[model samples]
Target: KSLTSAGRTVLNLALVVISSVAAIGAINLSTRESSDSSTFLLTADVVAPTLTLSNSYERRDGIVLGEGFYNDWGHLAEIHRSTRVEASTTVDDCLYGWTKVDTYGTETFTGYGDQVEMIFESVGWNGISLLIKCPSTEQTATYPVMVKYVRREIRLLNESDRSTFFDTLYTTYTTEQVDGERAYGKKFRSIKRLVSEHLLGAADKECDHWHDDAGIMTHHIAFTLEMEQSLQSIDKTVTIPYWDYTQDAYELDDWTDSDIFNPAWFGMASPSSKDHVITEGRWAYMSVGKQADTDGVRNPYGLLRSPWNTNPTPYILRHRYVYDEKDGGWTLPGCTDFSSAWSYNSLGEYFDELNGELHGPVHIMIGGQWWVNRTMNFSATNGGDFLLASKFLWRQGYVRCPELCSDDTPDDRCTCSCPDELTRYFRTSRDFLDQTGLFNLSDGLFSDWSNFATTGCMTPDDCFDTVVKALCHVGHAGEMFTSAAPYDPTFWPIHGLADRYLSLKRIQAHENETILSQMWSYSHDGNSPSDTRRVCDWSKVGDTMGLPDCYVGDCAGHRAQDLLPMGNFLDRNESYTNEEFYKFMNPRNEELPYIYDSFTQWPACTDQAICWWNTDGAC
Candidate 1:
């Protein structure tokens, strides 16, 4: 069952009230002094059992066919994960393995390494903890894992509308056997979910996923989201990262040109999906690290998928607008005598406003290759999609908590498995956690990705935050961030942050040739007509790299006052017209946590202000 907008609003309001009451300690049901009364400060602890080599079978001959040759033969990477024997526990160890299979039945063995003990301990919110020898198999290894989230589907109107929607969307495949060679191979796949019924596609007769199962397809949307964090700790596991793709024979360099992104061959790319491209054109959305533009006059926002190599050349994103009679087609937006922001009425509009008939949720399908299929840690399609979404949230605003800072209000627990990319940023920022929460099997870093497959389909409401935090941590933004604010703390500081804005900018330029050309020039010559470089460059922007050194401790023998002068002022006390501050601090909070105290005061200021930073070019 999916939630409607009204339902979402209700849920949001209910949560706000509940959270507010909890924070102020206003709603107490206990009559006498409670024996165990402690103000709850949200915190998370991550734990993953250290994998140890119990045994391994490499290039072992296994499986058989009718002929002399072995039908299924492949090299295996096997090992066991061991945990210290505890007085209360029954199991002390876990065994696991990873295998690389070849089609021709030839096997080659690879070496395995040491076994680390799984240690479950308590940690402070502000201290740092790490798994001493976690398995990566190889450097740049990305273990495929899923981060599950809650999704809500909505049907705007009554039964008639609902019936029509289901009719067009729901379809089942049935096959009849005629000859030994097989007579028919027709499987039904619904297209109604691909294009908006209110837009140009529904009536088209050519759409394949279209059907006439009125009641079933009536759902206008399938809005899935994270409700909490979902993580797990396994005795033993395997991890394969993005760099692994380069090892594949068929993997392509660029997403658009790669087998993974190809719609026809691999069946993974869904360019026709509403969320994949700009409604104005069939241009697929591109990321920031990938954008480059050289020529000043060319389209800066153009869909850029550069050819193999160019010396010092900037390849900005570029896309083609191909109009087709087919339901899924591109059309550009424009204005003659009037001017209104193309996608929104005003800047006040949030993502919900942009998620209209023209805009759609991204659909990611993961398992096209064997590498994705064999792993229990991740679901090829759904897991990857959710993980990406989770990473985006973490990158944009989420902050990491040190294990030592347990007394303070920590945003969420850090699983030791928090993406290494993010851990680098936190370590650089000195945001280590020493002790605050207990690190058990449930809260371990390595465990989070593994929990998604089960928690996603079942305990969605409870796992949303966990999923969001985990995904956000793994993505590229973690290493890129130079700030020290959690998602909520640095809302304004990081609002319109580097990654997301660039993504939006790329989409905006997809259909506008003039804008595309301008973006191209800016990317290539560092002359963005729209001054987008300010948003793209972390060094120039107000990131952690350029911030004043506000730390004082240890061997330097410096005075604490000098390092943290006006440390009390570190707490926010601004009276902004909006809730940017609360949003900045407790970003994931449904309702902002209002902190009223002189200890939590911000210096009086009109415009957003930061200390010791100069704009390189322009804003």
Candidate 2:
């Protein structure tokens, strides 16, 4: 154990050589290029995380994020939900319930980075990852993950052969939004599986929630839930997308007549289409999983959609904050923008007013899996806990309640005869979706909403539970509430709006650790000031090269200190027995990886407007 100075120097030299070899190994793993070229080398500096690196989800860049108080509740509702927040009783005083539901940080995008963003207007997780990769190909090697990387393991390099290698990889690997420059993966059919593999590949398998829980829960992680299992069962690959009717201004026109219903966009027209097969748009020619079938059969029938309000629709784009048909296309504000009606004022207003105004209308409009007719809201079932039908009663179709269903019926019919219990907790489609008694439905702004929020702790509420019911309505026959939604190809971008909303709010409020600390410290909430940022972006506190496998136990010479950190992301919602919730805030500081710009103005490449989803335009 004891060595002279010369002997110690020799030992240290050997240690240095061994370390150098390990560094080379990391570089080689990341640099393993396709057979054609080994030009792409990834690193943290050239590539930044635009996704919300929420601590709960192992820091995967977010295609989904958190909001509202109930969602932040650390345990399942059975753990500690208060009497005032119970879902069953709230419907009795629906308006009163809306007012009582806390709006803390419950905002979520169920089918995140899904559609709309794919319409050449938004950016999905798969898309975001691609952006980072395309540019970073020319980069020097570094650790796979940026946070708390081994200091000298991955060496830096500023020089390389002048190869069009990265650019070629970009064009060949994927494409820009609709008709932009049509590269390789735009057709939806070609890249579905690969994209799925890529996203799941970035995650840890056994780290809890979506991985082993049999469903996806992305409030704290950038996961797509049991979708992967469903896809795996069918030997399929990938994600789904959600299409909101309010994102564009088409109430004036017949929605059914619009191109959105074209096979390339939302799906085929409901009446004429059969077997749930999509026929026209980019997704027209692909195979996707089904709610009724588990074998992952090819949808013999094309996708279907019968807009509830094709004629003078109430779901018309209320705020005119539209993303053009291209992924990187500019975002345009309405001639008479009304987003303030949905986004401004109190956070509660954002959720309550948006129920029917923004969230609920989409359910009724789709009238598919989440069909909204008084004719059907419940039926007797034989087994399980809360199923897909009940998701609408709970979350924004964001997290899954697998305990509510049988393994065989995971994505199918919920045979559970718990209607009374379901009814008690979940709001009726009609009562929950009413647009008349909104908390603050006017087109007014929350005067000093920014400043107060900046200096205030997020007040937890049940309003988020109500919004979840609206966003995740379960009556329809399609993808509304199921583990297989991601297979649809349209689910991600539609939900990307949720992620975008929070990012925009953070931008508008000019929030930071100082502001968040002021709120957490001054608000007198149970959480300490440091938790605000650490909870949102834990890497600041500490991080490591994520484990090589999905192992939940200690591995790779490090312990999983936060293996299942800070609650299982409101699994119980109002059903939990605990009163505790993480009153933390989002801490991502990079220029938004994605933005909803005004297309009419042709957003410039300068400033924070670089075309995040573009090809030729300066991104």
Candidate 3:
């Protein structure tokens, strides 16, 4: 529809373009229309805005709500995004006139430019709308439009373990509805667990999705709360605690040499470090359900971690723990500046990179088995440097793939509508792609925030490639048990830190925190594995794939209003899908289960740190 990029690049070996901006390849990123995309031309030094317009009357799919945001500021000094939606008329045909929709999300200036947004829904607009602006000073221009990706807001889990899980969770219940019974909310963990069970029990398991339910990457949080609830039910005083590995002094002698290894916390030595069962704590006594293992068997093994079991934070990624005394900030093993990383043209193309670098490391370093962590690099195939795609595809049984990178490989194909925030990381002409694979890349540019921002001088080079790879290296346990990595209690705390980091980035990047919308692909390849699915077909993490109709589990072919219920194995017939279930549909509003420890004023390892850049002071 718009001028596609990623083509006609000036070839260069040192630098490569994964995909053309035209979005011609398998990677699909039509998520959000560039809010600043216009048909007008700009004079040398002018900054203007472009907008996508629509009205409340233009109801197409379910309802018509549009979102606009300016996430990239690479070019002009002062850039803005503006939209004017008309009911029966156009921005130009004032003869019919139009009204403005007030759904502006949030705006911020990230050195590059101003990021502005508005979340619109069915009632937000009245009629068909048109975008009316250009990159520079020009007459009003009108263009066609569509879309929004509001982040999903999850109410923070009760740190006290008082049980406020489902109140605003899947189901929105007011105080009156809650009836003052906190246990009612806490008990919903069973439903959440039920969903996880359905996901894990699938004949052809998509363990990654189940282990981490492909939404805002919050499934792990859900798991943490469920486990905490279960444990608290027993001790009433046991609340899941977090391990802040990024701090300066741990009072326990830092991360690597801390008491986390003590049986009182997380037992270090097991009869076999290979099956490094935490011999102490409630986790030791707790028996787990059937894992996404070979026999779907309840083997009753202890928590298994890698060599650094005596302590936490494996040497493989220990350097990342270096503390920046300047402001008490430390490095995240494979952390990316969520503010700007991969928010571009094809989120799917780069999805695996994030997994390989960031999420993958936790599982590998912590879980010592699976022969996965041993390798530093990975290939799209099954038996590459690590067990990436195959593990995800192994489904409920940890089945291995013979070798093929297709639908079976959950590392790709999430349906997304990207925003102009992508513009900051990409420029049309570059020589970054190789025929070895379409958009397939070997990441690793984020040595640290400082190194990433300094490497690329031109192109969107400094934008996407430079920063997104700030992830921990991938290896075994994470690779092998990637599906249900959460079975290991340690998974919760690591994810907690990661989640906190993401929230920190969001708070640092924009003023608005409301998640416009989130989508996950419900499509799964039949029983066995296949290579037919392209890079765009994989839904790594929680990406939603397919177009008009895509869902997580048994909730397929359902409408937003009618789709209120928990996920359950159809074979078990334990799922609830009726008016009674309507109370549980994801409300996507401002309710959260946990709040991140604030670090808005933390020191900067580099300029990428928003607070440091804005205040001119690291503290």
Worst 10 residues of 1 by lDDT: 223-232
Off by over 4 Å in 2: 1-247, 269-271, 274-276, 290-360, 370-476, 481-483, 511-588, 591-619
Ranking by TM-score: 3, 2, 1
lDDT of 2 by residue, 332-399 (tens): 22212223342243443333322223332232233233222233222211111112223312221122
**Could you give me the TM-score of model 3 versus the true structure?**
0.36
lDDT of 1 at 428: 24
Between prediction 1 and prediction 3, the one with superior lDDT is: 3
Q: Model 3: C-alpha RMSD to truth?
A: 23.3
Q: What is the TM-score of each candidate against the true structure?
A: 0.18, 0.30, 0.36
Clashes of 3: 71
lDDT (CA) for every model shown?
0.20, 0.24, 0.28
Off by over 4 Å in 3: 1-203, 206-218, 225-240, 248-255, 269-275, 279-356, 370-385, 389-480, 508-590, 597-617
| Clashing residue pair totals per candidate (backbone < 3 A) | 115, 83, 71
Best by TM-score: 3
Q: Identify the leading candidate in terms of lDDT.
A: 3
**Against the hidden true structure, what lDDT does model 1 obtain?**
0.20
